[model samples]
Target: MMSVPNLDQLDANALRALAAQLVGELEQRDRVLDETRQVVAKQAHDIQFKETHIRKLTHEIAILRRYRFGKKSEQLGGEQGLLLEDAVDADIAAIEQELINLGGQPSEQKAVSQPKRQALPPELPRIQVRHEPHSTTCTCGCQMQRIGQDITEKLDYTPGVFSVEQHIRGKWACRQCETLTQAPMPAQVIDKGIATSGLLAHVLVAKYTDHLPLYRQEQIFARSGVRVPRSTLAEWVGVCGVRLQPLVDALREAILNEPVVHADETPVQVLQPGSKKTHRAYLWAYAPGVFQDLRAVVYDFTDGRSGAHARAFLGGWRGELICDDYGGYKACFEQGIAEVGCMAHARRKFYELHQSGKSLIAEQALKSIGQLYEIEALSADLCAAQRQQLREQQAKPIAQTLHAWMMAHRIKVPGGTGIARALDYSLKRWAALTRYLGDGRLPIDNNWIENQIRPIALGRKNWLFAGSQRAGRRAAAVMSLIQSAKINSHDPYAYLKDVLARLPTHPNNRIEELLPHKWQPSAA
Candidate 1:
């Protein structure tokens, strides 16, 4: 509010004072500008973070759309399909982690602070609303007579609801006879454990079939007001596996007796005894009859992928063995087993070459392979002898043509390219791949068996690793039964529950009847 003298009219002292004041004002402005820049920088960082997240979500959605609605597997072919699959996998993992975080603090916990209502499950038993009088009397001051009232529903929350089942065995007493008679307690899967058959089945299905790890199940039980621990759930599983061992034995026997079987293996991480680190264990799947035979599959858990493991389980059994190019089956084949190669494996090689934009040699091979499949397609309903004849008439020529084409192109393509690899693969496996043409009983590929073992693959992603070698074998047993049950069109949970209930009482001599193919659900 004070006026300043002009520099030209004032003395040096006044001018010097004004100059110092102006310098102070400039420094204050600089400080304010610095503060503003810091705030802007912080805001810019947050915006960048939000933009990156948005871009990620958008990319994930686009990938999901493409995988769901875009060109299918055959069109996308080999590598391209894998890329899309990986993208979808990343999105799914992100969602799973988000779900895990969400599950940590459930909505029930927040109800104390904010009592927001939600829809109760329709299956829950409900209590009718308690009516209250709106007024003591009508306008005439007379007692109001009873009339129809409107009803409304509101969700009520009960964190956990459970009941204690009182298993009171009937006891008969006669004072005159001075004697007492009581029925013996029924046997359970766990001799001393309090879990029922239904509970055992629920736990088994949750962990193995549904891929819910025991820890997650433990959390679920806590939320449901039960204080079951992961260790206890795991013990139940192990005990159930032991009780079901006889059925697994029967399944293996039935599988080994079959004339044709498909075999495949997948890696599993398992902790070996005396070793702190885990080792890569293999789950060897032997499907007795996938396509035309029985739906039963037996899995052998081995510590290594050696040829000896296949030979050991197979036990010198002579039959047709269909598998991939894994040389581990060489011993089995050498032991008088008819080696059948998967045409699907050969086809996939060519598919990869085509996807790589390599020579048309791969496409030509695929076309020839497709012709063979087309013939098999037409003969789907034919019996074995008829299918054999049909294959000899039509499929034989396709295999022969594909073989000749491979021999011719093997020299043309570069030695290390995809086309060259495909040609070499088909040519090397020419005998085994064409063996399917000899027997209609043989499947075109090991894909069906692969489907059976896919549960183990998906489950491994959730469970991460097995605790021990014995634990891995137990897992194999459950997986074998579950997959066999699935292929036989039986509800796995019901089958397991029934088997667990009856296994203890059922005679070991009649255990074969409890197999997936032969088992009948006992009446409640």
Candidate 2:
């Protein structure tokens, strides 16, 4: 260490310079301290935020556990019970994953032991897969002898058949090396997964297409001589959903490429974060026009029925949109997207009035609308040009006469009456309603998309609600491919299996080839 000089021995100028140096050192020290404090504060804040998140997750898990194990009255019956149990299993899995992500351990629950399983059916075909040692020679140059073998059987399912995969692993050991060797396990869609691609496909098709929940699948698998846990099945589903997202993205782009597209939205319930309750979410479906050769539909899931979601999805793709008069789409129309209204919506208003059996005007309106539908039926088999010609010749006159008759009747009816409101609905949107007459490619109603949404509606009765927003979107993506596969007359299970098997190595730029419309099953 250097020795300090006496202050009295120094000159006045030197003393002043010394004071300046001291002041500079003090400022530098202060700056360093300030920076250190800022870093510590940030770290503390981060730790607090993480702790809060962990507590919230812990609370959610507890609630789910209670619901899963609580009262019998809370439980449902039949198909709904299966769906609810599956949902609980999925939610628990999802929460555990989140906990793991947060650097926390998943709370352990004791597994309930199951009874002895029944033997598998004798009629089902069994495929043997032999896993043997690559080499019988040891490091010491001694030949190894074949010892015993272990055989494990896993039940696998194809669409309509159940098969058993007999995995035979042979044991080989050398006395010199004192080592045993067996062939390494093959890679699968899920690492160390007992499920085969065929089994995975069956689960997916059953869940997404058949709308059978995971718990139901669990029971089914149990019946087949294996008791696969619902949690494991949910994990597999999550993995498949992630793997299949790229294909869904490609499908969305294809749907948007068409000149005329069908757009519609349906409500689905989604569980809100950190709560036991759920909120309404919308699944917006888009498809190419009925006349377009591309037979595919894509679904987008949004947390709300906001027009912004539609605008974001459509993203400057100026095309004719066939949809009902929902104000959510008004913004889209204002942005220069051509709106082709559903004639069915207009007819429904009059149909409702006629059903009331109180309005002659409504009956007249239905007769006129019926004439329009008859024209559409006649043109169904015709080419676009011929269909348009027929529409202009036949349907246009009827629509004009209907418009004139409605105007004449409106003056005779009271302002707030049902018939008056029905008339206003048709007249106010007459241009959009009649726009389909000029283009044969446009559908007469939003029924095509409505039909596409029908399966989702039916599925809601079984599965009840989506577990979360991510789950909703995942459901939408998988359903898009499934429904699109059906639209193209391809088997959904075959399509999904082939795609899932090839997805890991399938070229990203050429992902469109895996789409339902263009996909061809592999020869192998």
Candidate 3:
């Protein structure tokens, strides 16, 4: 600190200079103080943000715990209830992971202890893995004696069988070395991975194909005498999804090669980043036309149901597209892609009208649609030319009559009425709806693709919503292979197991061979 000069000892110039210096020092101090306040304010804001995040997490934990352990959970029944339980388990684990990331401990509860697990089956085959010290000599120049060994049995599952691995680690004394040595464990698919490829494949098949969530799989595995954590299972899924992407890409290319394709999209919910809220997303599915020899489907996942996504996926491929009346597909049509509208969508409008109340017009429309379907059923097994010829000879007249009836009825009903709306839908797109009559390669409706979309709809019920966009795309890729395998009559588990084991070393150039339609299982 500087000492204050006395006014009597200072000249006028000295006094002015001292005053200027004092003002500069005061200004410097004020700037420092202002910076300090700004820093403090920023820190306070961060603390409040973290505190609010923690509170939100804590609240979510409470709600999930109540759902998991409360009476409301007890009241749930049937297959859906079991699926809900699995979803809850996964959600709880996910939130706990988030809390751990935030440097917070997961909340613990003491109520409702679970029942004891049963023993493994005695019939399952057991494999022995031995662990012994690298050396038996002691550091004191004396040989160590053999000691009793400790064995632990872990339950493992393959596709259709349960097996056990007995790990035997021998205890060796080393008085001279003053340390114990053991054989190093072998490498696995993942570091310290608890599952083998077989088990990983099984878990994946169950989750993506059977619609069994990881939480449910955890319960199933626990009952089998091993309780794998859902988080671990999720890690396995992530790894496998990355590994299998090459094959999914090959499948998509194969689908695009066909002259005619079926395309459809379904809405899915995705958890928004850094928030508890979810946003709407889409899973776009593409497959070869019904007449195409390729038995495969590929899925593209996007965050929104936009036309651009469809254009991007089906880029430059101007094949015939059999789809619904979604305006998103209009851009594709404008690009010179042929459109084959779904007849079932038109039939559905009248079907709904008929179901709601008796309507003579609606009944007549259904009868006409039913006749057209009968003609399609008769030509189901015929060749393309023959089918098209048959449609032209028989179904075209019925369709024309239906068109005339709709046109005549349009003037009778008010524009806003359900019947009028149904008639208008069929009338506006009549040409595209009946395009199948000219080309037998084109499907009569979008039902074939709708069938492909069913698995996703069913899966949504159990998995609830995708955890992230990456997770959603991963699911879409895996399910594409699974569904395609089913389409070709291949068992999903066996196919996945073989593919997972081979994917690590399979040549990328020949990746197409692994697609479901061409895949041949490796010899045992």
Candidate 4:
């Protein structure tokens, strides 16, 4: 082979040009790698699925064989079923581990059984047990002195027992003056209410985070032999929402200050005043600065999915907004807010078309979108300036090429067809779609906000509908704190409990301390 190329021989411009060429080659290689990964993922999914089915059939076969020969079929079925499950889980675990070693994404549906490290809680009360032999005396018939003793600790649990706590103060009287005085009562989340801070925290977490409806919570309380009504719990939640407003306000301010924000909306069912029927409402979610370690998710509840809702939510703050092809957001762009389109949305349109039928145009569009995504995956870990430079060098060309192809194909496709619609959607949003090339901090998609909206969608499926508009507002306020805590990777229950316990006595001016981005456990 000839002598190896040396960087020292290359000048600055030459080195950059060479580097660009190498980056292009690497990008091509990455595209091939990603396609291979997708194929492997699909194959792995199929294999695991087939393996699970085979195991099930084998268990059934064993049971059938037992039934044909003897009377212990029921027992054999149970045993075989459990053994097969364990085998399936172990095999899948090995397969997943192998895929991980090979630097590929594993199929999400695979069942992997990994041992969980179980230990007693460090803070819970523990019990110690001591074991001693009855014959501890020396064999020579002499009494032995105890040298050392062994102790073991274990965790113990007992069913919850309810109790009532009452505060009583003694009255002092000055006989000459005939004056009586007593201590002032301490502040609380609910004044003179039977519920304590801990109980209120549980109710809020259960209702909003855990998706437990008030009626279900009432049933749970009854199972615990408590007689609290569902109405009482609802009142508690509404009160907490109102009290938590100061912190939520601080959260909104912090989020709105960020340079980049992601916004999305989902439909909600609400009962209108003086009307037996329900009206559709919307929950608008705004997430700020997802690139940072600490971020905030703010939810605004509105009566309709109009552009005014987004304008009101993002009042006077001008920055980049990543969203889909929704017409409601057109006004935001019109009002001078820079809009960045979601590549995922564009890809999804083509993905549906590809799945519905085989079309070279659709497949080529998917491939082009995939190339842009590969460039993004490569730049995920770089800083903003570097990432922007990389995008300019690598992603911009692909985007330009894809846009040209789309414009050319849009004219040839028949009107009103799915393929035509996909092409039109992409062509209409071309500027926003290519916005990420200039700003590295902005993602190619609004999946960040979309993810924040998923919980609300799931919640609606269970809670069914909001009692009224007021209830919808309360839900938004409470969900903001819970989801923000989740964004910061803090347990929602613990964060809510800490906030509720302190908000009673915490100063209103310092409510920012209770915001999820700034809040931390007292011990932490």
Report per-prediction Cα RMSD to one decimal.
Answer: 26.8, 9.2, 13.4, 28.8
The digit string of per-residue lDDT tens for model 1 on 19-119 reads: 89888888999999999999999999977875665555445444443443445632233433332232232233333223233332111121122223333
> lDDT tens digits, residues 28-141, model 3?
999999999999999999888877887887887687667667775343555445444444554555565556656777777523543333454666698898987777777777
Worst 10 residues of 1 by lDDT: 105-114
TM-score ranking, high to low: 2, 3, 1, 4
- Give lDDT tens digits, candidate 4, residues 1-524: 12336989888998888878888888999999999999999999988876665555445434323332334333223433332222222233333333443444445532132223233234444333234444434445444444444333322212243333344433333444444444444466766555656677777888788777766776886676555655456546756776787788888888878888888999998753223466799999999755645588989899899999999888888888888888999898888888888888988989999998987899999998888889888988999899999999999989889888898888888999999999988888888888888987888888888999999999888776665565677789889999999988898877887787688788888888889988878762
Off by over 4 Å in 3: 1-124, 128-156, 164-194
TM-score, predicted candidate 1 vs. hidden true structure: 0.68
How many residue pairs of model 2 clash at the backbone? 0
Q: What ranking of all candidate models by lDDT puts the best one first?
A: 2, 3, 4, 1
Per-model TM-score, in order, reads 0.68, 0.74, 0.69, 0.67
Best by TM-score: 2
Q: RMSD, model 4, all Cα superposed?
A: 28.8
Find the candidate with the highest lDDT and give its number. Answer: 2
In order, the Cα lDDT scores of the candidates are 0.70, 0.82, 0.81, 0.71
- Model 2 misplaced stretches (Cα beyond 4 Å): 1-125, 129-155, 166-187
Poorest 10 consecutive residues of model 4 by lDDT?
Answer: 150-159
Instruction: Give the per-residue lDDT of model 2 (tens digit) for 1-524.
Output: 23457999999998898888888888999999999999999999988987888888788778766766767676655654555555655566566666765788766662353123345556669999999877888888999988888876666777656888888988888977788877766556665566677788888889988888888788887776666777778767866776787889888888888999999999998864334566899999998988888999988999999999999999979999999999999998988999999989999998998888757788888889999999899988898899999999999999999989988988888899888899999889989999999888888888888889889989887777886676788789889999999999998988888887777677899999999999999987
lDDT for model 4 comes to 0.71
